[model samples]
Target: MKAQMFDMTRMWGMVTGLVLAIAYFASLYLGFKASEMLPMLVTAIGGFEMFLFSQDVWIKRKRKHG
Candidate 1:
């Protein structure tokens, strides 16, 4: 099947999540404060990605059962 826009979005979300996680850890390892904003931003983006992933699963299940 051809890739859908949602698929592309999920891919990007995965990449973004990885990058953010690495940056957050690297900052700490480098002896820098992760500042207040970084963690919040990561959490917000991670939540959004989780939502997208769940939606994808729900869609697949619906199609399979129906």
Candidate 2:
């Protein structure tokens, strides 16, 4: 069996996306009403990109494994 090769760029992007999402949700739940919504919107777009990239990665991984 071959070990999976991980790409650092994708990993970093994913990590950053997750952090952004966590912070956004945290601020929202913390009653930060004065918080600007622009950052949240940006984070959501970033999250969507990250999700699509990861899904593609998953499909590639499955193909490799099978």
Candidate 3:
């Protein structure tokens, strides 16, 4: 998707990041449950989401008042 199309007010990317972060933590808290993949995936995805969300937010702010 085009970066400009993102909506900071909607915050979908941030929310998804939070959820994925929680899932990663939960997996770690549950003793990893014999697999090391889930938590890693969650963290990776969440980090990317958060990165994208922050970029989108900054873009919106700049466009609004720059």
Candidate 4:
């Protein structure tokens, strides 16, 4: 079968990113000190999820071209 352009595997990464983003904002809203690392930790997790989702696209491109 031909490769599909949009795969479901990336959805998990997207969902994870969304959850982390929410948590990041919630942490700040809940009065966690800005000087604390809690918010940043959530931000990092969200960023990593974005990277994972984007990496899936890169891998598909590589497979298609090579």
Counted clashes in each candidate structure? 0, 0, 0, 0
lDDT tens digits by residue: candidate 2, 1-66: 122234555566667777766777787889775357648665776876768789999999999999
Determine which window of 10 residues in candidate 1 has minimal summed lDDT.
1-10
Q: Sort by TM-score, best first: what order?
A: 1, 3, 4, 2
Structure candidate 1, residue pairs in collision: none
lDDT of each candidate versus the true structure: 0.85, 0.70, 0.69, 0.67
Tell me the tens digit of each residue's lDDT in model 3 across 5-58: 556524666676577667767877887653566567667766777786798799
By lDDT, rank the candidates, best first.
1, 2, 3, 4
lDDT of 1 by residue, 1-66 (tens): 357876887788888878888899999999988878878778888999888779889999999999
Best-fitting candidate, measured by TM-score?
1
**Candidate 2: misplaced stretches above 4 Å?**
1-6, 33-66
* Candidate 4: 10-residue stretch with minimal lDDT: 1-10
Residue range 6-61, candidate 4, lDDT tens digits: 44444555676577667667868997655456557667766776687689899999
The numbered model that scores best in lDDT is 1
Cand. 1 Cα-lDDT: 0.85
TM-scores for all candidates: the values are 0.75, 0.48, 0.51, 0.48
Pairs in clash, predicted candidate 2: none
- What local lDDT does model 1 show for residue 64? 100
CA shift of 53, model 2, Å: 3.6
TM-score of 4: 0.48
